[model samples]
Target chain A: GGIITQTPKFLIGQEGQKLTLKCQQNFNHDTMYWYRQDSGKGLRLIYYSITENDLQKGDLSEGYDASREKKSSFSLTVTSAQKNEMAVFLCASSKDWGANTLYFGAGTRLSVL
Target chain B: AQSVTQPDARVTVSEGASLQLRCKYSYSGTPYLFWYVQYPRQGLQLLLKYYSGDPVVQGVNGFEAEFIKSNSSFHLRKASVHWSDSAVYFCAVSPNYGNEKITFGAGTKLTIKP
Candidate 1:
């Protein structure tokens, strides 16, 4: 079975610092996504890449940027960390672009001091 | 403009009891619905999905969900829940196929009593 791996399971950043989260999937999926989950809130999509170098903005993409350098990897960047901000960033991928099943990574918890 | 709503924030049920969690969605087109489970500190796992054919779909761990298109609701049910069923459940909806962003509900925390 293929796996989606996320780096730095726990991330601690200082206020105003830039942070980066990386995701790699061995499934060779064509579509990848980044989402943020806040306490007591549903997951919000930040960015998605349909293919290499392709980017799409989701509802919550204001402070985030994403890149798909290759077919198997997608990365997310937080422009600037905010104090007292804490959330989990999740990475997911699907074999196809349309409504298909998605496989997810374990997620990275971010805490800004 | 698509959204999903899970009315219950938390539910407590005794082991071996039947369980049901309510989920409502708002979308203009034919909706694609899904139920996902998340154990403590774990990633979300797809339990079941509904996309046009059968209204009822069975999933892992004896879980099932029935989609009521008329009511715009998809409710998850389990004949007999176990302690292992304790987790957070999320309901999600997407407007159309292909690379569309899915909207998720706030989630319901299920606590199975021993």
Candidate 2:
């Protein structure tokens, strides 16, 4: 069994601060994605990487940046945190793209003050 | 654009009662549907998926979902409810053949009343 590990289960940041969250998966999946979950907005994709060094922006990629340093690691950075932007960041990976079941990390909760 | 709509934002039922959560999706061609559950302060867990073949797909924890293509809906059902089943359920859809570019609905929060 493979597990998706997310670092710093909770994040507390000040407004305008640039916070980074990390994700690591041992499943060796080819695709990794980062999503932001608001209270009632569901989950919005921020970015994804098909492979190491590859990146694709999703619907909610405006204030975020992602990096797939290695096949096992994917990281996301919040450009400038806002008070209203406090939400949970989730990381997921899939064996392949589309219609495939996704493996998810526990997620990192961000609170902006 | 591919999208999902979960009409009920919150649903409450008593233990041992039947459970149903609604999900509607939008896509021009054949669509890929999925139901995921998230426990408090946790990540989303795949409950079931519908692609091809049988209209009814079974998932973990005795959960099942039926895909009604005619109605453009996929609804999750469980015969008996348990307190552990309390969680936030999300419905999502993908346009392409596979899981590409998926969109999620706002999600339905299920609460079990004893």
Q: What is each predicted model's overall lDDT from 0 to 1?
A: 0.91, 0.92
- Give the poorly placed runs of model 1, Cα more than 4 Å off: B97-99
Per-candidate TM-scores read 0.97, 0.97
lDDT of 1 by residue, B1-114 (tens): 788999999999999999999999999888889999989988888999988888999999999999898899999999999999999999999876544677899999999999
Residue A79 CA displacement from its true place in model 2, Å? 1.2
True contacts kept of 1: 0.71
User: Candidate 1, clashing residue pairs?
Assistant: A97-B98, A97-B99, A98-B98, A99-B98
Residue B36 lDDT (model 2): 97
Real contacts recovered, all predictions? 0.71, 0.80
lDDT of 2 by residue, B7-56 (tens): 99999999999999999998889888899999988899999988889999
Locate the minimum summed-lDDT window of 10 residues in model 1 chain B.
B94-103
Best prediction by DockQ: 2
lDDT of 2 by residue, A1-113 (tens): 89999998999999999999999999989999999998889999999998787899999899899999999999999999998657899999998777788889999999999
Clashing pairs in 2: A98-B98, A98-B99, A98-B100, A99-B98, A99-B99
DockQ of 1: 0.70
